[model samples]
Structure formats: C-alpha cells, structure tokens
Target: MILHILDEEKFLKKAIQIFNDILPKDNVYLIGVNNKKSEIFHERIQLDNMFYVETGSSRYKRVFQEYAERADIIFFHNLYKSYKLNLYSLIPNNTKNVWYLWGAEIYGLNPRINNILPLTQKAYNSNLPLLKLLRKRVLSKIKKNYEWHLFKKILTNKIDYVLTNISEDIDLLESYIPNGTSKGWFTYFSFSEQNFEDRIVLKRNNILIGNSSSETNNHIDTFELIRGKDISQRKVYVPLSYGDEEYKRVVISEGRRLFKDKMVPLTEFLHLDEYNSIINGCSILIMNHKRQQAFNTIMMAIAAGCKVFLRDENTIYSCLKREGFLVFSVQKDFGGEDAMNPLTEKEMLRNISLCQQLYKYSTVKSRIKQQILSILDEQDKT
Candidate 1:
C-alpha cells in the first residue's frame, strides 16, 4: 500500500490524479487532513481506493504509525513541524519516505528566528503596515526559533528523497543537507492540470490580483504604488477566513478610496473550477513580496497563460529569470542620486510581453506531474 498525506484540496486532487495513473489500480490509499466532504468529493469521481483521515496534529502519530505498518512507502505532502515531530522520526527506517517541500515549511517567513522583529521593522519602514501586522501575528502564533529547530530535526531523518516545486528551493535545501547533490533534491515546476473550459469572457478591462492572506505583506506595497499612480482598473480577489476580516477590510477600503469605481473585491472561497475561470480571465497577476519561500500561485497563473508582474528582487523572480521565463519586472528603489531614474513604461511593457510569450513555451504543469511520478517510481524501485 502507498500512503499519501494531503493537506490542501488542490494538491489532493492533483496528487490523486497522478497516483492513480502510476500506482497499482487498488494499491493507493489517500489520507487527507481535510474535512470528510472534500475527501468524499475527491474519491467519488476518480480515486476509488481513497481513505479519509481526519485533520489534526495530535492524532497524526497514531494514524501514521498504523498506516506505515502496512504501507510499502509513505509520502508527506510538505515538511510541516507537526509531521516532523510525529511522523518523520517515528516512521520505520526501512520504508521509503519522501518529503515534498512546498512554501512555508522550507523557506520560512523570515531569514532566521532572531530576524523576525527586524524584518517587521523593515516592513514598517517600507510603508507596508498591513504586511507588518500580518507578520507580527504569524510570529506571535508560531515561534520562529522552535520551528527552525524542528525543521533541522526533520532534515536529519533518513528521508529517501526530497521533491520541490521550485528550482530555487533545491538550493535552499542544499544549505541544510550534507551531501547537497541534485540526486536527493528534485526540481519540478508548479502546475494544476484540472482542465476548465475557459469561463473568462473578459467582461471588464480590469487587472485581477489574487492572493491568499499569507502573502499580504509582500503585496501591500505594490498595491499602494499602483494606487498612487491613479491606476483605476484593479480588482483584488482573496479567499476569506474569519481571521482575515480586519486585514481584508483594510485592503479593500484602501483600494476603493484610491481607485474609486475601478476596484472590486472578491472574498469567498471559490471552487476549483470557478477559481480557475476567474484567474484565467484576469489581465495580469501581480506579486510584490520581498522574499517568497515559493510562488506557486504566480506559476499557476503563468501556466494558465496569464501575464504576470512581480518585483524583480524576489527569489522566485530571480529563479524564473535564470530559467529564461520572461514573466516579471524588477522595481528599482530610487533614493539619493539615483532617485531621478526609474523603470520606463516601455521597458516594463516589453518585459510583460516577453512573459506572455514565455508562458506559451513553458511546460511547468507537465514538469510538476513528472516530478511527482518520478518520486513514486523511485519508491517502487527501492
């Protein structure tokens, strides 16, 4: 039996699709950390061999041990700390274990635990108050020092392989691993292959900006810059949760005051098909985070053939640039003597055009699928 632990619905759907294609027809079992509705919904259509696991931190150890005893291989979707303490060390040494590095688990919110306060100070100085608040809250809830220690502990385990969606993340992992060869670190692109008939009719001429709440800090300043420029055509779409109401209200209110009738807000959790349709219809996607552990959403938008605009300094932009994916623009800080010079409109437009062309040529989605399958194949061989 192959044990697959999934957290998000999007990832669960994609993983199930790939596992069904490669694994023995009835040998795969899905253990989800989501509600029963999502698990039943996913299994109802394509994954007949699926098994539901309730979402929790304390129960994971017992559940994982029970499943690990009977399973030939175990795959954890991401290297979360709860899993690190419960499952990583407890899994039998003989069973092949694969760790999938997504965003937060690897490149954490700050450079180091001690740097959290300083990072928030920088955000405040940069006129990104919203981001500072969000960062502060996250820092308070999850201790950076403790998480870093847990992350290091998990890395010491005998993980057979590490699969990452971002190529840049391979280098990040290498910093921690001893034998830092590509043999253990696999680079895969981000892609979701759920085919949706294009429902984007382009009813309006607005640029659509979509993000999860975790990214508020990175994007707050960019939105401010665009707002100052009198850019009237802007729409913001973020998935809503109870904790995000205050921040969401602040952002939406600011956008409305700046753009007037041009700003629109979408806050509901959209179904996959509906979300895809909305994103596909957007004119451009913008991300302005100073440091992003991973920018899967940007890649997903690019895979959907949408033009993307991102700050040049981000790790994701740097990696995309190295990969020859011309999908971003670098914003330069102009203070002191260099204050007079800034990026020209023509230069920015040229980069956006290049990004659109590159999107057409890129096989990001296929690359992700290939990496997942490769991990499964390696597990089978061992």
Candidate 2:
C-alpha cells in the first residue's frame, strides 16, 4: 500500500516505526512536509521506499493533490491549526486519510477560555471554594471540547480511521466518533538500544526538566511560579527551536536563573540520535499545563524509568491514573488563600515513591505496539 505521511518535528520517527513494523510486507512510502535534509536522512536509515517534499504552506495544497492521487492512504501526525489538514480536502475521495490524534489536537486551547470565563465569573459571585471550582470548570471544558472537536471532525471529514497510542485515548475518541475504531499505535520516542540498560537504573538526584515546543509555555509559566518553593532540586534544560532567542531570554529573565553550565539550547534542529541522548539523560519529567496534553517527553521519561509530574485532573492524567500510574498534581493553592497547602517537600517524596511503583509494572511500549499491530492486521483484511 502507498502511504504518504506529513508532520513536523520528531513525531515522524514514531510514525515511520509503526508503518514499517505493522506493514513490513506491504509497499510503503514515507513523506515529510518540511526539512528535506532530515527527511532524506530518515529515508537513508530505513529500507522501505521513502520520499521528502519540502513544500511551504502556499504550495502544500497543489503538491498534496498530486501525491494524494498516487497514494492509497494519507497519514497526518501532530498536525494542528498551522499545517492545516484541510489540505486533505484536496485528496481523492477514494484515498483513505488517517489522522493520528496524539494529544493536544484532541484537547483544544489551554485554559479553554470559552469554558473557564463563565466559571470564573460564577466563582467571583458565589462563596464556593474558588480553586476547586476552577479545577472542575477547567476539566469539564477539556472533556466537553475534546468530545465536540473530535466528533465534529470525524463526522465532517472523509477520514477513514483515527489512531492513537493509548487505549484510553481510543475510549475518549470513540465517545465522540462512535463509529471510529481503535488503531493501536505507540511512539518510538524512547531511549536507543545503546542506552536502554543505563536508563533502567533509576537515579534520585537532581530532577531534569526540558521542553522543546511552544505549546508548553503554560508549563514553563507554572514552573516559574513555583520556582525555589522547596520542591525537589531542579535543573531546567530547554532546546530552543530556531529564532526562539526571544522566548529563551524572557524565560531566563523572569524565571529561576538556570545555571549557565546546566543550560542546553538548540539554535538549530538536531538528529534523532542526539535528541534521544539528551532526553534519556534526564531524571524526572515535569509538565504543568492547565490542560494535560499527551506529551512525548513524559513518555520518554517513563521509558527511561524517570518520574513524571503533570496536573492531576486533566483527561490525560485521569487516563494515566486508571492505568495505575501516579504521575500528576493538581494546583489547589497558588496564593495566600490556601497558604496552609501541603508542603512541596512531602509531595515530591510521595511522587517519587509512586514513580518507583509505576516503573515496576508498566510496560507501555509493549502494550502500545501490540495494539498497533492488531489494528493494521484488521485494516488489511478490510
């Protein structure tokens, strides 16, 4: 089968792995939207037929039109508002268009202003617990928006299928797209074989935190707000994309002064091998977004046996909780109102203990891989 994949950043690695593993015997073609050099490198490493199209947004519609006619299926990974999948509108109706909703795409904008504004006004008028009400409002909005968007898109589009890494994700998607079937898939954003053995040995020293994309600005803000508040020792590492110097400067000036020796910034993109090394070397992974999106950084930490901390009440958090993973925290007290909140020291220790337990039993990689294989087999029969 001819498959055309379009995406940005490192997610292409996972898509390529899944395509090769599940459809090894079938004819497959890999295509990248931008970064022609990286696409060429990716093609060199794999035996399957691969091609790269470094077309800008202005030309994508025209380019995709030609490619779509020749291909049987089109797969989009990490596609958002910018690299609009509306280009799929150009694809021939007979060619299947598959959207792999990894995480944030399912959940709309952070804080979900549409849902939170009313709750904020209500909380102001009423004398209810403000933080608790806010949390409820925020979570409710995420669930409602996630369902609305996924359902709307699935019903409106000519999409043949929706694929995700976690089974719980399938549940969330099916809640909206009742006709949608689960296509089991996993990401290949883990430690390389050379470092796998070393990663298994858990370390309890300074916590290592990193962020690469702009979507994580909320997380950066929360960590800045809590900096030097008696949490576990932290060493922040940021891999800034090209022309992100302004963001880096602002984060450094307003937040905790990152130790110059510990800071890691990327002015240009690095290959997957180098990126893996930096991610594998980290200890704990931290994500503090109001809406807990499915981030590969957290997954990489889990694969490397590192503790991951995120907001507790979001859909992703709820899904992880059901799976027996304890890697989340809900913000209850921000200011003097809840000053008597639990100390960060105690919470950090508790989180560490839970991390150990989760690492012992969770093999997310294997479960996800099996699901992807099953989905592909079923798709083949159809």
Candidate 3:
C-alpha cells in the first residue's frame, strides 16, 4: 500500500484528486499533518480517504508507528520538519521513502551567503525598525540552519526517490543526496496544455510583474527596471496572494507610486479558472525571481500565448530556451524590441505550438503517472 504524508492545504486538494483518480482507494492511504494554517483546510476538505492528525499528538505518533510497517511506500510532500511530527521516528527503514521536491524545499536548502542576513539589501531593504530587522535576521538564520541539519540527518540519507524536473534542483539533489537515492523528473502540477485551435495571441503591451510578495521575486528590482517607462495607459498586474505581508504592503506602495491608477495588486486569493481568465487579457509577463517561483503561473502565461520575460540567469529561462520555447531575457533589451510591440500571427502560432508540446495537461498527467509506475517498477526489481 502507498501512504502519503501531506500538509493540509487547499492547493494540495487538486494534487490529492489526481492521486485518488490514479490509485485505488484501498491501495492508497492519505495522512495530513496539522499545522498553523491547516485547520481551515481540514474543515473544508472532508474526505473518507484522508485522516487528519496533529503531529505533536501521541495518537499521531502511534498512527505513524502502525503505518510505518503496513505501508509499502511512504511519500513525503516536502521535508519540512514542523512541530506537527517527528520525521525520523515516522519514516521506516523497511519501506521505500519518496520525497516530492516542491520548489521551496529545494530553493531554501542552499540559500546564498549574501541572502543569509535578512537585513541584507538583497532580501529585505524595507523601512522596518533596526532592532526588529536584526532580530528577524538572527531568527531566520537559526531556523534555516536547523532545518538544514534535520534535512541532512532525516531525509538526505534515507529517501529512495526524489521527484523533480528543474535542472538546478537536480544538481542540488545530486550534490546532497546519498548513493542509491534515485531521481526522477516529475514536476508538481506545473504543466498545463494549450488548445492550438482558435488561439488568440495577446499583444505584448500590458505588463504583469512578479508572482508573489516573496523576496525572491525581486519586486524592487523589477519595479526599478520599468520605472522610467511611460505606462500611463497600460495596466500592470502584480499577484501578491500569499507571502510576506510587509513585503506585499511595500510592493503595493511602490507600485502605486510608480504607476498610480494603472497599478493593480492582486492581494486576494483567486481560483485557478478566474486567474487564468485574467491571464488571457495580459500580454507581457515579467518575472524577476532570483529563484524558481511562479513556475505554474509562468507556464499558464506561455500557454495563453503571452510573451514571457525572465532573467537568463534563471534555470527556467535556460531550460525553456533549450526546449525551443521563445522566451526573452529581461537583462537584454530583446534586440531593442519594445514591450508594447504586438506579435505577428506566425510568432503567436509558434508560441501556441510550443506551449501545447511542453505544458499540456494531458502530457503532464501521463508523465506523472509514468514516473510513479517507474519508481514502483524499480522497487519491484530491487
């Protein structure tokens, strides 16, 4: 039997649905870790297939002890050690353990030395108090180091398989993962298909900047990039759905100051369909992320036949470029091309074809299932 230990989150419900459809109800068991924001998720998603347990509770530990022997495979969503459960005790030696590398898990594993200080102008150059910023910096460092230690001890040596697609993350996994730990290309819900039929290519005019309020988005840098441009008529959309609240406020203030009425900060949570509909209207998507973030959103934009601008330094840009996707770099001026320039019919069709080939839902679903089966087959062989 397969056992999945996931944190309770609304976003994960979609992934759970995919799992339920792929595997038989009797074969797959779901356990949720209770966390700070998990209660509401638990209340909303009431499923017979899932059991909610507080990681700190003795009963939770008992459940883990029982399941550790029963489960043939134990899949961890992310190797985040929370007050919810002790990971070392829960993971069994006999069972095959698989860790799904959500971007954050890998991204934060090896943070840059420059970004270690929260007070660094690179990460947090806000107008907050000096003492508070220092405290935040110290606390952040302690937490990251502790998590790194736990990761090395509990997961790096024990996991049998890791699921990821990013080239950078693969390198990181190779650098840290112990021998006998296999890696597979299974990106988490990042790909979606585009219908080539009746494709309407949007003009690369209006700007959509950044994915979230996270410091990695480099909202300050992106805003600074287009600060001098005359965006009086063009609408700029910035999604700050869920991240650092203080950063969100700062971004909003800066955005308003620069673009005034043209600035649109999407602070409230949006349904996928609703967000996609809005994406259709947008033309240019500029992501100044220092790390991999908003991959799903970026793919969605590409699917919608929008011009995507990312730093060449980013893995996504290089990977997509290698795969024949026509993405541009924010650093280079795109041969002095204006962002407001409209794409030709040929260019639009090319983008649509590429998006369909790379990010289609059907393709993504098949790959995910195949990867899972492949891992199982390897286990059987062993």
Candidate 4:
C-alpha cells in the first residue's frame, strides 16, 4: 500500500485525483494533516481510503499507526512542516519514503548558488513575534541535538526518492539523504490543471502582478517599481487569494493608492476557469518572486501570450531561459515610463510553442503516470 501524507492545500485535491487515475484505488491511501481543511477535502473527494485526523484526539495516532503498518511506501507531499517530524519518527526503518519538493520548503532552507542568508536573516530580525522566533530557535537546537540528528539521519537515509524538477532542490535533498541514494526526476509541474491553449494574439494592455500575498514576491518593491510608470491607462491585477492576510491587505491598500481604478485585487477565491480568464485578459505578467514560486502562473501567462517578467535572481529564470523561453528579467527592466508593452507576434508564437512543449496537460499527465508507475515497479523489485 502507498500511504500519501499531505498538508492543507486545495491543489492536493486534484493531485490526489491524478494519483487515483494512475494507481490502483485499493493500494493508495491519503491522510490529510490539517483537521478543518482535511474535512473540507474529504467532503470534496469522499474517498474510502482517505482519512483526516481529529485534532488533539487520542484516535489520531491509532488511525495513522494502523495505516502505517499496511503501507509499503510513505509519501510526504512536501518537506517543510515540523508537524510531521514526530509522525515520521513512527514509520518503521524498512518503509520506503518519497518527498515532493515544493520550492519554498527546499529553497527557503537551501538557497543553492544564491547568497541569500544575510537577506533572510535581516528579514527574520524585523518585527516578528519574539516568542515565535525563540520557539523556532529552541526547536532548531533540539533538531540539531546529537541524538535527534542521529534519529533524523536514520529516517532521511530511508528516503528512496526525492521528486523535483529543479536541479538545486535535488542537490539540497541529496545533502540530507545518506549515500545520496535519493533519485531525482524531471517531474512536470504536477499541480497545474489548466487547459493550455495558444491564446489569440491581441493588443495586450493590462499587467498581472505577484502570484500571491507572500513576502517572497517582493510585492512592495515591484509595486514601487511600476507605481510612477506612464501606464495609468493599463490595469494591474494582483492575485491575493492565498497567503498572509495582513500582507494582502497592505498590498490591496498600496495597489489602490498607486493605480486607483486600474488596480484589481483578487481578494476572493476564484474558480479555475475564472482565474484563467483573468490570465487571458492580461498583456504583461510580472512575478517578482525571489525563489521559484508562481512558476505555474508564469507558464500559463506565457502560453496565453503575455509578456512575463520575473527577477533574474530567481532560479527558474535561468532554467526557463535555457529552455528557450522569451522571459524578461526585472533586474534590467527595473522601471520604465512605458511599462506596459504588448507581445509581438514572433514572441507570442515562441512562448506558445515553449509553453505547450513544457507544460501542456497531456505531456505532464503522461510523464507523471510513467514516473509513478516506474516507482511502483521499483518497489515491487524490493
């Protein structure tokens, strides 16, 4: 049996469905970590093999242990949360483990080639809760304790596969896994379920800014960059659907103050089709993520013939450039009098071709299916 553990992201709902299509229903089991969100997920999926834990309940450990015994493979959806550290300790030394590297979890911990430690330290030193920082420090010390490190090293050594498309992520994950036994794959962006098409070339006008309300997007700086530009006629759309609410409110306030009627803040949840329509309307998409966040949004914008701008420091910028994408860097185009530029026909066609080649639904679906099946085959051999 394959036991899949997930955090409370709605994308994992679709991810679970993809797994259901690829694997035998009886062999796959899902456990959601957050109670309220998991209940909502259960309502949507209603899967017999799925279980959501009741917070602070005695039955939680019992339920998880029961599934753990039956599971031949334990799959961690992402490796960020310390909540699962205790649960991971319970898995027998024999069980094979797999981890999907979400960029934040991996890159936040491992900057690869970038010297981001000073910046990160400075950010942490700002007006964050003292108790929270103290608690995190204490936790870090505990995790670094010799006995705890030995235990963690044992568990990490059992990680059979670390799944990620990013080369830096692979290197970081391998550093933790003993003997560097973890295998890497050029995995597709597994969460995106958009029906990608070559959007008709039009006179693109509006600008799409920031993927989320996360501080990683450097929203304030990017907003300042475009604030005084001669593009009052152009609309600026910011998707503040998920992330820090305080940050979202700040972004909305600042955006309105800057663009007034032209500022569009997507404060509420949007259905997939609705969001895609929003993407289609934009001519320029600017994501100022310091890491590899908002990549799916960037790809969607590219497929839709939007002139996408990402920071050069972002690892994905170089990766995409290597893949023949016509992506512009914010480092060069820091600010301009005319910030809103339409994609030329030549640029549009090239972006469309690249987007389809890399992220089209059929390609991702097939590759994921093959990768998972191959993993299962390897498990059978063992």
The models' CA-based lDDT, in order, is: 0.53, 0.50, 0.69, 0.67
Give the alpha carbon lDDT tens digit for every residue of 1-382 in model 2: 5455555345555556655555665434444456633423243344436554454555566566666677655665544443444454465666556666665554553223321223223323253356755765687567556555544554356666666545565666465446543254544444333334433444443344445434344434444444534444444555555323444544444344434444444445677667656655555555555444535556555555555656654555666667565454535433333322322433444443444444322343555446544545555675
lDDT leaderboard ranking: 3, 4, 1, 2
Candidate 2 local Cα displacement, residue 22, angstroms:
3.3
Task: Name the lDDT value of residue 110 in candidate 1.
Answer: 31
Tell me model 3's lDDT, rounded to 2 decimals: 0.69
Strongest candidate by lDDT: 3
Q: Is candidate 2 or candidate 4 better by lDDT?
A: 4
On TM-score, the leading prediction is 3
Candidate 2 vs candidate 3, lDDT winner = 3
lDDT of 3 by residue, 276-354 (tens): 8777777778887656667778877877777788876677887778788888888885345386465556776777687
Stretches of candidate 3 above 4 Å error?
Answer: 26-35, 38-43, 55-59, 81-85, 111-123, 176-180, 190-196, 199-204, 340-342
Candidate 1 vs candidate 4: the lDDT winner is 4
Stretch of 10 with least lDDT, candidate 1 = 334-343
The CA lDDT at 316 in model 3 is 81
